[model samples]
Target: MLLLQANNVERRFGADILFHNVNMQIDEHSRTALVGRNGAGKTTLLKMIAGITEPDEGTISKAHDLSIGYLAQDQGLDSQNNIWDELDSVFAPLHEMEKSIHQLEEKLSSIDSTTDEYQYIIQQYDHLQTTFKEQGGFEYASKMRGVLTGFGFGEDMYDLPINSLSGGQKTKLALAKILLQEPQLLILDEPTNHLDMNVLNWLEDYLRGYNGSVLVVSHDRYFLDHVVSQVYDLDNQTLTHYTGNYSAFTKEKADWLRAEMKHYDQQQKKIAKLEDFVNKNLVRASTTKRAQARRKQLEKMDRMERPTTDDSSIHFSFHSDKDSGNEVLDVENLKVGYNENVLAGPLSFKERKGQRIGIIGPNGIGKSTLLKTILKKQPAISGSIKLGANLEIGYYDQEQQQLHPDKTVLDEVWDDHPEVPETEIRSLLGSFLFVGDDVFKTVKELSGGQKARLELTKLSFQPINFLILDEPTNHLDIDSREVLETAINEFTGTVLFVSHDRYFLNQVATDILNMSSTGITHYQGNYDDFVNETSTLSQNEDKTTIPSTTQTSSKKSAGQQSYQASKQNQRARRKIQREVDKFEQEMDSLQAKHDQIEQQMSAPEVATDIAKLSDLQKQLDECQQQLDQAEENWTDAAERLEEFDQE
Candidate 1:
């Protein structure tokens, strides 16, 4: 069923048109993404679709009684209630229904059975019970708890007042509350902004299993790729729908641009040929008729407009003036934190020349603090940080503190190098999309993205052999982030940066440093590689414990002892192999059953019937649990067999 549709939607600001003729649709359970560069009116469009604002022209039509939950960028919940109470407020109607049911039950027990009032009261009680169950009245508390846990809020934090929480925590709570509400459609803008990787993974899983349609606008490509099935590209003052994820949309957009350019070129050539023929032969009596016919054809032909590509991205690259030694950085037992407190470490890691190391961990694990400690901006709690000889460092701070708020964009770069000419400084700023009057804008007046570009401009002006960036992609859009990735990849210098953008890490990092409260584990690959390796290790750790066998030295020959041990090992291996095979069969059967239940739940007849859908959903959930257990058993048996083989 179509949940919403925007027909010929046009948004304008006074005389300026932000976007026009935008058309899109959202069906039930649709997973859609809205993507564009910053200042492309994505948020404005979302507001119009969410009924928070009216479009200047055209119409947004939503289904009758359709409910939408909109979470704006950085929007947080403001309440005097505690965290638990705030989320609990979403189930007010269900609570009222429960009260009504209890009152009806009491009246039914006291009244006579043969009377009309008793029958009416019993019917009312039965209706309320059914509605309550169907609306998840019995599961509301558990559901709320599950969502809170997924968002990284534990039971201990439930009693905390909303006013006592941080801004990011409040935003997360807002999302958690909206999810519990379970509106027919969910509209999110920059929902992943304050989320760490763990919370991000949890949210992705939740959104995938969400029972309603989703429309999200986010800069996290990895999240978009996993959560959204369709992408609407809002670019060049128009919205174009692509029937795939972000990765697929990129490929399809490139192909579309090439095709558009080809068609435009072909049409232009035809028009030029007709104009030349008319110019040459329109005056001649014999070919005048043919020239007139060609002119008419040209007039009647449909013209193709030139395809426009938005290339106004920050264009700059990092270049090292000199090479650094083999060992760019060495940290031994480095405890990074403030004052006498320690957030992470005893952490020890080394950075070789030309290696791009990505640091990732949960929130407050001291990723940025580690970078500052290495740069000597903050004193470490203990341990040592050694930099190789002749290494010039360039650092990008996530907070943009390196930029002077009172200074203009041009002066920010120009003041760094007074020897460089003003024209040269202006040209450099232009490359970062700071052109003409934009250079005169104060740093404080600049947006986060603009400030980020200014900082990069400064970094590019320096001759640094080692670059340490702390959340460099924090405020950057998709295009700017891609540019930064390319610059890092092409740089001859070493890079050690912290980021939550998994896509950026996958593109640029040659190694990943997984930090934790205890220590940091270094993995020799990108983010995806680190995840794959860590997941394998985690599975191994979760395997069932195997009993150890003791081998006794016998009073026999060495050859006889070796033959006997080999036979014993072979028998053990066969036993483990049989166990592995049995577990595999069980897993296969459970997976088949799981898929079958899912198919039944998706059938139209069952989907519209709430009771049937609920039953199938329970069956599917139970089957999934069994499948998970069977897979764990298989992993354990397989590990045992592999250990035997190794022995």
Candidate 2:
């Protein structure tokens, strides 16, 4: 059933129209991920749906008695109480009802055993019990506990002051409280940003099992891929819907853009032809009908505009030497941890020149620590880390460290490369979106992202062979990230980056060093390979053990204990098999989608018009090509898994 509806929704700010004619129906079972560029009014649209803000022109209706749980990007949860108290507060009304019911039961049981008053009270007591059960009172406590635990809050933390919790922890607690509320419509914004992967997975599972409607705004593709069944992309002052998860949405959008481009091409041709005929025949009285008809056709056409495609990682870079024989960094039995908790594995790892490695793990894992250890800001406890020769290292801390707050932006950027003129500095900064007066602003006055961009100017300066970036995308908006991504892609130097930005990882990494509880596992491909490997492994598990097919055999390399090694190996193989099976399933699905798109494009309604037909045909071609590539990758994954099964 539709939980909420928005018809002819038009929202405006000053003279700008954020969107218009956005008719929508949000159903109880549908999960939608809202996506748009920053400042595209996603949050504003959400506010309108929540009734917190009004649309300038529209009618919005909610299903009768429908309750919505709306969580803003940074939830302002007012509290000074304990965590458990804050969590249990969600059940306050139910708790009060339970108390009243219990009191009435006591009164009914205690007096006038055969009286009508007693009997009526007893009957009412039974009614209340039924009502409480219907309201999920029985599961309330356990569900609250489960939610807290799932979101990484320990039972011990239940007693801690909510005020003492970190901002991120507070966000998690707020999320837990909302989850426990279990409203008919759940709305969340960037809910997974501060969550670790394990918690994210738990949340994903929870949302998948949710009975209510779900709508969220998030940049985490993994979360969207797992939780959302549909995508509502807000673009160009319009709302467009696509069926399926993020990956499917990507393909669907690509096909749509291709179709649009084709339409544009065809319409241009038709317009040209009509214009030619009109120009040639309009003066002749004998051909007035043809000319008039052609003019009408031109006037009546609902002109098609070219659709934009994904910015597909920019093409940009530096020249580099491939050979390294000398040891650039050395360590023995290195170990790093904070407050007595271990961060990096005792088992040592090293980096050499000509290597482009990506360190990926859940948020707050040792990815940052490992990077810092290499930088020597954090000491390694017990394992050897030896960096190989001629490595001139340049580091990009996600924290935006290199920038000086007191310095002017121009002074900061030109301080090191002063030999270059001011014009060159301004021009270089302009590429990163710092234009005109922006270059003259003090670093202190700049926004976090602006400061990070200023710091990134160093990427243009250093003649270093090795670049170590810790979440270079942290301070970067999508555009800046794209610029830096392009520059990194073109750089001929060795790079080792620690990142959770999957898109960035997908485009940049040539190799992956995945840090997990079991230690580091090196994979020979980019981030996609890493995700496929891990996700594939996860699917293959047999209830308890996580098999590490490649991770096990490399004991001398991975340093897993001997007694459990073989068991791990067996499990790993099974997991690999499962992953391979999943790939086959996915590849088949992709092929089906390709065929479906082809059919739609081939339909007469879509294809009869030369312009529209050309567009559809072009999309059909891109889909076909994508399908072939997906199939090949699936086959390759299957072969590797087969090796595990053979064992």
Candidate 3:
């Protein structure tokens, strides 16, 4: 059954068409994602589907009596009620029914046993009781509590008034209320914007098991990959559907572009050949009839227009003047926060050259604070930081605090690199997608994404060997994020950055530093490796020792005992090396099989096969688990190898 459908949707702004011919559907139990670049009218389409706005040239239809819950980005609850009361209000009808039942019970006690009024009241009471039970009135509180707790709100916060809560808390409460309402269709816009990892995990599981249809607009690639099975891409004034997660969509989109380009190229060549024959032979007397025939045929041909591609995205690179020393940075017992409160750490860590370290922690746990203290923008609560020789720092502030609000985009870049010519500076700005009149816009007039691009442009001009970024991916869209990831991956400098984007971390981070008020725990390898190791620790009573740095052997004299220890150490190192190789091979083979299974699942013939889909889903899940374990084993072995080499 179709829950919602938008047909021939056309939206316009003044003379500009935002999007047209946008057709979409959400069937019962469908899990869909709407993805597009920033400014691609995704939010507008979502609003139209939720019935918050009307389309200019199309109709949106929803099933009769269907309920929809829309959670817009930055939408929060405005209420004087406490958290629990606010969430409980979703079951207001149930509460009202319960109240009437009690009233009916009281009236029954007063009425005579033989009266028709008593009989009617008794029937009404029974009806209401049945409705209440059907609506799950008895389980509402427990459901509410489950949602609240999953969103990181505990029992203590339940009594807090909604008006007193922070903006983020209010937003969470709004989502919690929607989940508790259990609408037939759930539409969410940028729902993962302010969520932490724990909340993200919870929401992923919740949505995976959700009974109703879900359509979400989010830039969180990792979240989309996990939750959405189908994706609707809104680009170039149209909508296109892909059958799979974000990664699969990327691969399919690329293949589609290549195929389209090839077809266009072939058609263009044929048209050129026809034109050349007509041009050279039309004037010749001997070939005049043949040329005329060719001309007529060409005129009748339906020429294929070139396939337009949207490429209005930033393109730039990072460069370093020179390499830094072996130990790029060393933080010892570092405590960072304001007002004598240590929000994060008594942390100790060593960052070597060419190591991309990603810092992750919940909001207000001071991930950004750690960056500021290390960059000397703020005073550390305690401890020392050592910067190695020739370490020129480049910092990208997620808040864009380094940019002057009054300065024009052109002046911002030119001011930093005054030695460069004006034309050259403008060229640099254009490379960052600030062309024409856009360069004259004041920094304050630019959007968050624009400011991020400008900041990146400035960073590109600076010759730096070390980068310390704070939430670098905060305002970047998916495309810009991927570009940034590629640039950073190719960068030779050491990086110590804080980010919540798990996808970005997985792409660029070579190590993970989980920060907290208690201390910093360092794990070798990327975000997935960190998760695998940490989760394994929580599951087992005896926590496995995560691989880290090892000290050099102090026994220099060659006694029998020393000799035996050396031999054992060598054997262990070789074993670890072999294990690393084995897991690498296994990971490669599993990934290939994973891709094959996904392809088979998306095949037209197999797509509707329920039993086959279920079996393939089972296989995919198991393959994912095996791949994660293999990666973990590889990380552990690699770390052990490095440790042995260092010793």
Candidate 4:
């Protein structure tokens, strides 16, 4: 069954057309990933689908009984209730049932216990009690606790007033609310922006097994690949659907465009030949009828419009400096936490020179808290941090919640470092992809992603050898992410950053720091290495020994059937890919053989040698046959690849 449908949707912001003539249908159990450039109407289209905004033209239809929950990137928790109360509100239905059951028991007590009315009411009360139990109302508190923790809200924050939480915290709470609701269709915009890798991986598993459908608007490539089966790219004022994860979509989209270009070329040639016939013979008395027929054929041609091409990507590289002294940072008996409680450790961890580490754990597992303790803003209750000499720290806070709302982009940069000249400051911001009018927008108006970029922009201008970044890629567009990532990769200093962006982590981080209740655990490699080791642990629990540098993980187990199903899916996909690779090799061989035949035919000696020419012609025929077979095989392989990607 179709879950939702939108037809000929058009949206314009002022004079700029974000998108037009967009049509799409979301089906039952569909998992769609919406992607486009910064201003390419991905958000607007989602808004239209949710019926929050009216489109300039056309209508959107929703399936009967289909419930959608949209978690926007920027939202407010205006309630006065605490975080626990706020999240528990999603279970209002269960709450209502319990309330009614209590009321029925009270009514029975008001009447005579022996009366038929009282007896009937007692039976009704018993039924409501059973219903409440079945609805999990009896265990709702534990579920609430688990979800809130999963989203990163601390036990202290659980009772904190929602009105007092930070913007990012509110977003986290809102996400928690949405996830708890578990609606029929989920639409999450940049849901992973503030979440760390641990939460992200948990989400991947949750969404993978979700009974309902989901449509996500996210810049996190690794997360998208793990969850989404389809990609709906909103670009060039039209909706183009690619069936597959991000990687498969990339390969298949290219192949599709190439094939379209070939067909376009053929049509152009036919049109040109018809036009020539008409021009030359239209005025000739003998060939007037032939010219008219050719003209009619030309008029009937279906011209293909030019396709949109993605632009060149941006890149940035940092000037390399000598590596810092052996000990970049060392903490002794670090007991980090909020208010009063210890997080996971009287834990001690050290960042040696050239250790590119990724701090990962669930949302509230003190990933950011660890970085803050290092910065000295988040005071360690009892432990001490020792920093090496000449260690200059560049901190990227997720709250970006720094960058005074009153400060302009230029002012934010200039105010921080008065010694830096305007031209130099502007040059630095430009490197972070802030250009022209963008520099004038108040820090208050910047999106989370934008503010993140702006904050990083400020840090890049300063002389910092040691960098402490908290969700550095939160608001960056794809191009800006590449730039920031490149700068980090080339930087000679030690980086202790907290990021959930798997793609970024893969490219930049050298080691893995898994921070949990027990403190920090150091894996010998990057994110992939951590996943592999953990995967091994899952496979062999008894022999699994994690690093002493890291915290112990939760006692989590993957269901055997679920685990096997995932492995089987991967195996099947690989079988398909192997076939594609085989066909591609054969196709390449056929092309080489065809090229050899063409070379021989082009030779002057072969043209003169009639006897040799006949032999060559026979070989050429055989080669053509092989080429045709190869082409068919390639076509089949491509079709299968697309089919597999889309599903």
Per-prediction TM-score? 0.82, 0.75, 0.81, 0.66
Candidate 4 structure lDDT? 0.79
Overall local distance difference test of candidate 2: 0.76
lDDT of 2 by residue, 504-585 (tens): 7766778888776447777877765665576557646734444574444344233223323533453565457656767777
Per-model root-mean-square deviation over C-alphas: 22.2, 14.0, 17.3, 10.8
Cα-based lDDT for every prediction: 0.90, 0.76, 0.87, 0.79
**Once superposed on the true structure, which residue ranges of model 1 sit more than 4 Å away at CA?**
108-120, 282-287, 543-647
In model 2, the Cα lDDT at residue 537 comes to 77
RMSD of 3: 17.3
Query: What's the candidate order when arranged by decreasing TM-score?
Result: 1, 3, 2, 4
Highest-TM-score candidate: 1
Off by over 4 Å in 4: 82-146, 152-161, 164-169, 254-313, 321-355, 361-433, 440-446, 455-468, 490-494, 516-519, 535-647
lDDT tens per residue, model 4, 1-647: 89998889888779988788888889888889998878777888888787788999888989887898987876656789998888888889998998898899779879999999998998898898988898788888887888776766668877899888887778777887887888899998888866666667767877877778899998888788778889987766788889988766766776787888888888888889889999999999999999999998877877887655553334454432445688888888888888878775766778888778887776667777778888888888788889997677778888776689988998998998898888888887776567898888898888766787777777766777788888787777765676787688668788888887887886678898777787677788666667768777765765555654123333333342443354456456656886887888988998898889889988998999998989889988998898888889888988987897667
Better of 2 and 3 by lDDT: 3
lDDT of 2 at 50: 90
User: Which residue pairs of candidate 3 clash?
Assistant: none
The model with the greater lDDT, 1 or 2, is 1
Candidate with top lDDT is: 1
lDDT minimum window of 10 residues, candidate 2:
555-564
